[model samples]
Target: MKHARIGHQSIPRWAYLLFIVLAVFVLYRIFQHRAEVAKASQPPVRPVLVAKVITKDVPLYLDEIGTCSAYETVQVQAQVSGQIIARHFQDGADVKQGDLLFTIDPRQYQAALDQAQGQLGQVKAQLGLDRITLKRQQELRARNVTSPQDLDVAQGTVNSDEAKVKSAEAAVAAAQVNLDFCNIRSPINGRAGLRLVDVGNIVSGGNAGGGGAVLLTIQGLDPIYTDFTVAETDLALVRRYLGGPNVKVQTDLSDGSIPPRLGDLYFIDNAVQPGAGTVKARAITPNPDRALWPSEFVRVRFILDVLKDAQLVPSQAVQISQSGPFVFVVKPDNTVDLRPVKPGQHQEGDMTVIENGLKPGETIVITGQLALSPGAKVDPKPYDAGNPKSDRQVAAKGAM
Candidate 1:
């Protein structure tokens, strides 16, 4: 009505103040969000530890289970049958070749030898008399004092006597050999097993066809053998490098408490096993200390060949993703690039061989990979593998 109702009514001062406060609060939130977005859009810089790839020759090896065996096993037995008069070696003693192990009663053999010698002596005397008779008969025949038949008979007797003497000499030699066999000696340098027959036991010595009742067993321990098997599928590769000088082998106790023993491949079976489809192989290891025992199970590794100038990296540096094995490489510009790699053999003590996608002297991120992305800026630091504290921390973080 009056003056068009004064179009506007007067607002409270507190209301104006409240409107201003609300507007200011909204504007401040908008600015903070924009700032955060801008910061996020920029590349993220993460601190990480890096290591350099090394170049060296690394051996390729195949690992399998094996058994330790004596290189040579001999069954000790007496060669002649007689009473075991004495035993010269104790059970389980180390013996050398030709060492006397047992002594059999040689009196009978000696008597036989004496009788043979006497027989040989008698034959020789008879042969001498026959030779004189033949010569006298020949001279008498030449003088026409004796008939040709007499000379012929004398010659025949001399020939017969010579044959008898030869037979008697052979008998003496046989008797001598039997006497020598009475003294049982070690056939090889090795450790003897338990005595099968004690002293005073009459042992059958002659070839009983069953090795004469095994008196003892001797096993050559030094230069021991580790017999193992490999899959037939890998036979081609194994055969290729079989005789190569670079090929090597190692073995360790199955328990893994002792250090590995170094050796070389010595034998390969002519054919693969029919049922198992595995090829038998053996390695000879120098065991001067007798560290390896017969029939002991062990872990065997066959080193096929060495890759010269191959790239090596820390084992932890290799990461597995959907695209396969990859690693985060630290570029010279302090940026990390995700790279795919072809990983080869993984060696002991945390070392890995990279077949491709890496080069020697290149840097790789070893730790702090959780926060990394392709082309992300990084604050790289040299990784000190000798530092135990950091290793422990990394291990803890990985567990988490």
Candidate 2:
């Protein structure tokens, strides 16, 4: 029968369209939620600059501040009192041993020497005449014609004249020495400083003990000394290798005008300096070109030993944490492992020696370490020191 269907109404076309639209919107929402959850489950991949661990012979060394000093310093002084009549050398001239440096007036000394010679000649003539008289007296005594007292008197006169001759000879020697002193000579090979006494100035003689007026300063410059100090705490380590064959020193000037110089450790103070807690040390460096000067400050590196086949890496790859120094090592799967390392001395060319905790051929992060964590994924890029962009990135990241 027309039945209950007579009360049923047909569905509207607009209702069907609205239902389809809601179903499609629900499906989109579900898919979007699933995508967000998946993203949250995965770790973020960060980009970083990295380098490979290398191995080489690395030097174990200590760095200290030092100063260059002349190997030998001599203050040239007048050895004999006289007026400086002439200067034989220019200021700042390099001189050899026995080189003439100045000339003093010799006329007075020569006159004294002449006078002594004259007196010696007079004494010699008298001695000859007295000896002849003694011989005549001796002959008379033998013939019993002269008294013994006369013979004795003649002998005495001859002896007295001989004594006078000897006294004159002593005076001549003294005068000759004074004449030779007129020419001043350099005693050592060195570089002469400015002349303190001019050509016309009078200077007093200095004794062998370095007394009197300093005429000029001469310092030995070749093979100079680099003087430095070591802290008391490190004294033991330095002493252990004090004279070892491998132990050496390297010196660098702040100006960098000359190349770094290598030398041997020359001296070390026996006692530590009171109140300073340091001991003085010296290095003997060859300075054939005279590039190093006295009292010039320099950077000193005391090389204790060389570690053979030591693991090395870029210095920036090592980072310090609260526990100690650590490095980010990249794994084969592009993940990083935060590894603790025992770092050794930093070397030239931005390299550092790894005493422990790292192996050769391992990849390590040099930059972009701030965003890294243990087991974190990374896009490792090769570190290139020549790349400006990489350097800028490193600087911006504040990589250690």
Candidate 3:
């Protein structure tokens, strides 16, 4: 280096050589330290728990609490008041229209009818006398012994008697009507309720129990109605399903854990209640066994429509993140990836309908997604649900 230097600068050859060796060694050490640090900082690729692609049809049951109602209900009341002379129907008995339910005292109505009949008899006897008198007058006039004015008076007497007889007949008819009203008959065919009065108790004209206490409640149990409500958010979607030219609703109502009865939708309220934030809907159910009762609460199901071949996922896989509802998609390389999704109706138990952003064949992280990061290496554990044989397989394969 000194030999190559110009006159202004001079350097020894050994000094230059030593400086280059030290620079080369420092560069090598730096590279070695950098490699060690990079290896140490890189996370130990942890084996993560994962699930395999599960392919099956998920049953979707739209669940909501609903109530039951009777198709036709009537309150049995006594029309005529007297005294509770007899009870014709038992409590909770099924009755037909025109069946006698209660019997009030017929004595008062019978007395009135008897008085009317007596008046009618008296009027008939007087009319007979008038007829005889008129005939006698005519006979006398024909013999030139009776005056014309006297005969005319006899005719007027016969006419007055006839009008009196007609008036008495009308009175008898009205009294008969009142007597018939003493027997309280059922207006419709239905299930009857409890009896309000005993045989000896007196009943006022208005009600049987003397107060507003219902004498009996009769409800039609054959074809019962079940009422329910649905959220306003589903209105448009359900309307589209039910508003078609010839569309109808399919319903299910259950009591307790027993399987619900299948019913048909028949009525929907015209107006939506803004305060309740729901629409009232009704369905008809066959109550052949009297399983449905009046005022009994029942669960109602409304089938808006069916989603054909819609992608579905478990509710657990879906997580609410900063963006929106998303799922941890498990890639084939045993790494976790995030995917957004749109959720549909919530079905029974662990199933939910995926409206959008899901594929049928794609594997979603069903478990252990909370601690996953993008591109993190994982040791996937194939979890086989349902079948006992699959559980054995996981254990036998040593991937537990």
Q: Which stretches of candidate 1 lie over 4 Å from their true place?
A: 1-47, 208-211, 239-245, 255-259, 270-275, 376-379, 394-400
**Candidate 1 local Cα displacement, residue 282, angstroms:** 2.9
The top-ranked prediction according to TM-score is: 1
Scored against the true structure, residue 23 in model 3 reaches a CA lDDT of 99
Record all residue pairs in model 2 with backbone atoms less than 3 Å apart, i.e. clashing: none
Q: Give the Cα lDDT of each candidate.
A: 0.89, 0.89, 0.72
Give the TM-score (vs. native) of candidate 1.
0.81
lDDT of 3: 0.72
Q: How many residue pairs clash in each candidate?
A: 2, 0, 2
Per-residue lDDT of model 1, residues 266-309, tens digit only: 98899989999999999998788787899999999899998888
Error of 2 at 358 (Å): 0.7
TM-score of each: 0.81, 0.74, 0.57
Question: Which of the two, 1 or 3, has more lDDT?
Answer: 1
How many clashes show up in model 1? Answer: 2
lDDT of 3 by residue, 1-400 (tens): 5665675355667888999999999999999999999999875454333443334444333456676677788876665677777888888889999999877789989999999999999999999999999999999999999899999999999999999999999999978987887888898878887776678877666434364324678888888887888788877767767754333333344535455676778788778897998888878877787777777766665665555666666666678888899887777776767878898776655667787787777777655554566776555665444554654443344332
Which lDDT value does model 2 have at 75? 85
